[model samples]
Target: MSPSAVKRKLSSSARSVSPPPLRRRTDAVQAQRAAQTESTNHSHKLNFYSWNVNGIGPLLQKQISFTPDATYPLRNFLKAHEWPHFLCLQEVKINRADTATQRRVELAANAGAQSDEPTYSTHFSLPRDKYNATGFSGKVHGTATLTRDDTLETAASVPDFDLEGRVLIHEFATIPLVVINGYWVNGTSNPYRNPDTGETQGTRHDHKLRFHKHMLDLCKSIEERRKSVLLLGDMNVAPTRIDGHPNLRTSPIQHVINRADFNLKFLDKDSETGLKGIDVFRHLHGEKKKYTYHGRGRPWGESCDRVDLIVASRKLVDDEAVVMDTDICDNPHDRGHSDHVPLWVSLDASTWLNQSESKVD
Candidate 1:
């Protein structure tokens, strides 16, 4: 009785002590690691917005200005549509009379008073004259950046082009993005006259060539520094005659009307080989009316042009970037905003950084 019973008990204890199968243990370990990785990547999704608010003067004057009453619609839009992570504002002007401290305090107060969340990093790219000269003398013709200010990484603004304050660059997180907010000088209608040069420089001839060269140089510089870049704001040049109605044809300059060649040659083309640059915009909104600026005096009382654009490097598009709906805002009519729409685009930080690292080889 003792030998048989003891042997049976010993056999049961031996079976219980045996370790689980190797494959099963490996599967459990993998599942735990997968969950950990997922948690680590739970970063906030980026949302960006850009607008040329004509001139901030009309909204708020004096040393300090507030526009919550005027920006009610904008604030409402933000709450309704989920406010963006960053806002790139063009035509943000500060009176030359105000001191830097005065300007900052006033703008900050205005922003806070207007919206639920105020921008943390304020990068004001004043015009070239002001860039070197002191005081806010000439109209500050550049860009403004407002960030959530919650992120660990700080924000910065880079001026891509300095000729008459046409470009401003901003970066958020490790995402090195270049924002060129420009207002090119051009004609009023078909081919309007140059207020200064009259013939030598209008919307068509050498004026465009010179301005475009500067923009191209900026793009090249951004490419050299940042792995991914976005060239945006009021380009003022139509890519196709179809960009605006044929009946509104005001300019005889064929090139301005036909933007395909121009875009393909400089923007889409590779510098060395003269091949096409990435058609990033087309990839997102094809054939859709992405027109940002419009005219009011047409026969039908309405005419449109696609001037403002958000063009990204091929790498960003291929890796799946985000572009919000490009809609024309109503503030232009009342708040002295420019006759253009506000647009947005979101980039996946993880995807971009990973791809850039891989390309370093």
Candidate 2:
């Protein structure tokens, strides 16, 4: 079936399941994507970036132990790549003391503090309940989007199934460029296992599965609108061995390799699209072991593996999106950034708009 047709089918099916609030949000998202995709042609372009900044607190702390200064290194890096039209950031944590409105301003100021010009506008999704709580500080975890242009549209932060952090979305100048910033829950190596039931008995695994489902659902919904989608974030789960640690072959992480509920736990196994709507870090590099996570110690003390990822819709690839891995920092100790490396992809926004126009003719 055609890609657009596939999207519609998914939407119709999702709607059949209650079709009220979920349907409304999905429908609005679909319309927004469609409208964004049709807005401009070649003259305008969008650049998307994603990274997991482990925790903003450590970087902003008075005395830090890590090597590379997080604030300075990241700021310099952004300054160097100053031309990206749109940037998506995962793990853009915000302090609860600040309101959402206040947080965005702080982020913008922070970005500008590191750049000569504040070329990016910020958008984020924080926890709803936390914002409503009495004397609530602000969201603990979430995602944010930054763009050179002030054209980000209809931005929303869809809380994922885990209810841990936020997944963010926005349009780049109404062009068929819809960017999603995500930070999936990081898996716990020593999750609380029921002594009687073992590791398979808890809500941890279920939470991971729910996170994947939420991501897939969003991807499918966006595909339904047939826009060029760029889903970027710290995915936490490696789709393949190349994106995992080297020791995985001999002694694999049981939870990762097991296909028991693989289809439900990872994006590589969505039955309907079956990973069609997903692409990952492995797509850019065929390397292994080089990881993004370091055991909670110092930045480079003990390494885990690559969990961060940049996924693009197959439709976007066909539209000539220049997707690649931008492994900006190697040593978290040196950069004072997150355990994960920042990954970026550039899409020729004009190309999609122009091609769509041609098809109309």
Each candidate: what lDDT?
0.48, 0.49
In model 2, the runs with Cα more than 4 Å from the true position are 1-45, 58-77, 95-97, 100-118, 129-139, 150-154, 159-162, 188-202, 249-254, 257-273, 278-280, 296-302, 318-328, 332-334, 355-361
Q: How many residue pairs clash (N, CA or C atoms closer than 3 angstroms) in each of the candidate models, in the order given? A: 9, 10
lDDT of 1 at 319: 45
lDDT of 1 by residue, 11-68 (tens): 2221221122122225654455434433432453566667776665443433233643
Candidate 2 local lDDT, 1-361, one digit each (tens): 2112211111222212111221132565446544443343223444566667655544333223364433433444556665465556666556433454434333433432422233334455544332221122544566655544323333444534434445766543334656677776544443433333344444444555655667767766766776556767776665555554444332335465332333333344345554465454455555534566565554353446665666667665544554533443456553444556665665545554455556655
Q: What value does the lDDT take at residue 46 in candidate 2?
A: 45
Tell me the lDDT of model 1 at 185.
Answer: 42
Off by over 4 Å in 1: 1-43, 61-81, 93-97, 100-118, 129-137, 151-161, 185-207, 246-250, 254-262, 269-281, 296-301, 319-337, 353-361
TM-score of model 2 relative to the true fold? 0.64
Show the colliding residue pairs in model 2: 36-174, 36-175, 37-176, 41-350, 42-350, 68-333, 68-334, 96-137, 96-138, 97-137
TM-score of 1: 0.63
